[model samples]
Target: MSIKVENLKHIYAPNTPFETIALDDINIEIKTGEFIGLIGHTGSGKSTFIQHLNGLLKSNYGKIFINDLDITDEKISLTDVRKKVGLVFQYPEYQLFEETIEKDIAFGPRNLGLVEDEITQRVKDAMQLVGLEYERSKDKSPFDISGGQKRRVAIAGVIAMKPEILILDEPTAGLDPKGRDDILRNIKEIHEKEKNTIILVSHSMEDVAKLADRLLVMNRGKVEFFDTPKEVFKHEERLKQIGLDVPKVLDLAKKLREQGFDISDDILTIDDIKLEILKNLKEK
Candidate 1:
């Protein structure tokens, strides 16, 4: 499914002396089966915008459409909207409360009122999808699992519902290096296998640079750039001006370019930077 937000506006503590505009005239579109990254500094409205996607927060002004359905319509069912656009908030693992891992992962499907057989199947599929072994972890306490596995179990809870559009807000906020990498890889695998729209909100430039096919940079409640990663990162100076930095390798490539090398400004991955360096060395 696709999603579109037009002229979206949200104000926290509106009309009071503490009024704050969290989002201002925000516009965005996500095509079906696309992987999109939403990046912004703290208090830049990134979280505010995603909350509107699944009706977690109603917009003060503007409209949201999910596959031609106006989510803002009073007659619309938010339950259906949420089922289609599942949101996994930051530190989702903290919300797990069931006694066993299987029960925890089954929570969403059970809430959906799926039949017993279907719920069991969903729990099994979701556990496998997140790299958890169903036969091994089903009866164990989720709290006893490793930190990374616990996070995966939490993600599997949402995956069990099988939403068409999955939105993850800061999925790797507190994980260690390996945990972060594992979560990112699992997310990529899920997106490719499910062929669903994926919206990832993250502060790590490196993570988004590697994962997202398209990038949207937000600044002060406004979209600064919305394009492919190559196109967005090309504006290195502007990104830095807004307190966002380019990927580490891209920054290094820019330094190389400043030294009179013929490296392309669009270089993003470490492999791309290596190839450019090798090519330049060969040229000399």
Candidate 2:
């Protein structure tokens, strides 16, 4: 769904001596089915901003419109907002508490008052969407799985609700390389097949480089930039000044270019860089 934010501002502990400005005069637009990478350093308002999208946190200074409806209106129900926007927080597995994986993933659909058959179908679809075998995992306790599996199960719970906009916050945090790869694969698969709008809030510049169609860079409670990743990553000095790094692949490309290897500075993905290296080496 399309989302538009106008003059959004959020403050914590307002009117207090320890008050902090969490979000400031922020405004942006998102198209339906677009993959947006929300990037920032710690305390850059990334977490706080996503909360406002699903109405978990309300903004008093501005309004948010989802599909042209002002969610800030008193008549809008938070439940309706949440149904359209699903949020998967960092280390989501920590929230899983059901007796079986099937039950855990089915929780959201069940809460939506779907019939038992529909809930069961949702549980199966969600599990498969995350790369888990329905028959093998359905009966297992959530606690018995590996860390990554448990994390997927948690995400499956949110996916079972069939949200139009999926927001994942630091989805690959605290995982081994293999586990991180698995989760990213699931994310890619779901986005490609389901065609849902995705907003990925992450600190990993490399992950954003590989996954996001557009980049939204935030710094010190303000939007530093919002554009395509290629355009945004061009501001290497500014990003570094704000405590963010360009993608590692881009850094490698720069070093390779300096070493007399012909390559573009805007290279963002490892696969593209690898091909460039192979082609340049052949020319050598």
Candidate 3:
């Protein structure tokens, strides 16, 4: 589903001494099935902005349209909107409350009033999408699983709803390298197979560089840049001013270029840089 935000504004503690502008006239359009990477410093309104997408937060000013339907309209049902836009917050495992893994993942679909057979199918599909073996894990307690498994169960709960637009906020936060890789790979597979719109909010530049089709950079409640990763990373100085950095591989490529190596600025991954170095060695 496509999302369009126009002149969106949000405030905290409005009309009070502690009032703050959390989102300032933000405007952006996300096309259908696009993978967008949202990056910004802490408190830069990244969280606040995403909360508006699924109606968790209301804007003080402006309209938000989902697939051309005005979600900001009072006539629109937030519940219905949420069905189309699923949001998985950081450490979603903390929200798991069902006695068994199957029940936990089934919660959203069950609430949608789906039939028993359909709900069961959704639960099974969600677990498989996240790499969980349904028969073995369904009866297990959510709390009895490892941290990464718990995280997958939490994500599967949201996936069971079959949202067209999925927003994941720092999905890999606090996990070890292997755990993080596992979750990220699952997410990539989900996007590839489902072809749904995904907005990934991440702190790791490398992750976004590899996954996102476009990068949306926020700065102090405003858009600093929105472009392809290669284009956005071109402004290394500007990103640094906002306390952001290019992927380490890109940074290394830049250093190599300065030393008279024929490194392409388009290189965004370690594998890309490695291949380029090998190609150059072959040419020599």
Q: In model 3, how large is the Cα lDDT of residue 91?
A: 99
TM-score of each: 0.95, 0.98, 0.98
- List of clashing residue pairs for candidate 3: none
C-alpha lDDT score of every prediction, in listed order: 0.91, 0.92, 0.95
Worst 10 residues of 1 by lDDT: 264-273
RMSD of 1: 1.5
Selected candidate, larger TM-score, 1 vs 2: 2
List, residue by residue over 1-284, the lDDT tens digit for candidate 2: 98899999999999999899999999999999999999999999999999999999988699999999898888999998999999999999999988999989988999999999999998888889999999988999999989999889999999999999999999999989999999999999999988999999988888888999999999988899999999999999999999999988988888888999989766899998999999998998
Instruction: Give the per-residue lDDT digits (tens) of candidate 3, residues 1-284.
Output: 99999999999999999999999999899999999999999999999999999999999999999999999999999999999999999999999999999999999999999999999999999999999999999999999989999999999999999999999999999999999999999999999988999999999999999999999999999999999999999999999999999899977887888887898768998889999999888887
The Cα error of candidate 2 at residue 123, in Å, is 1.0
Q: Where is model 3 more than 4 Å wrong at Cα?
A: none
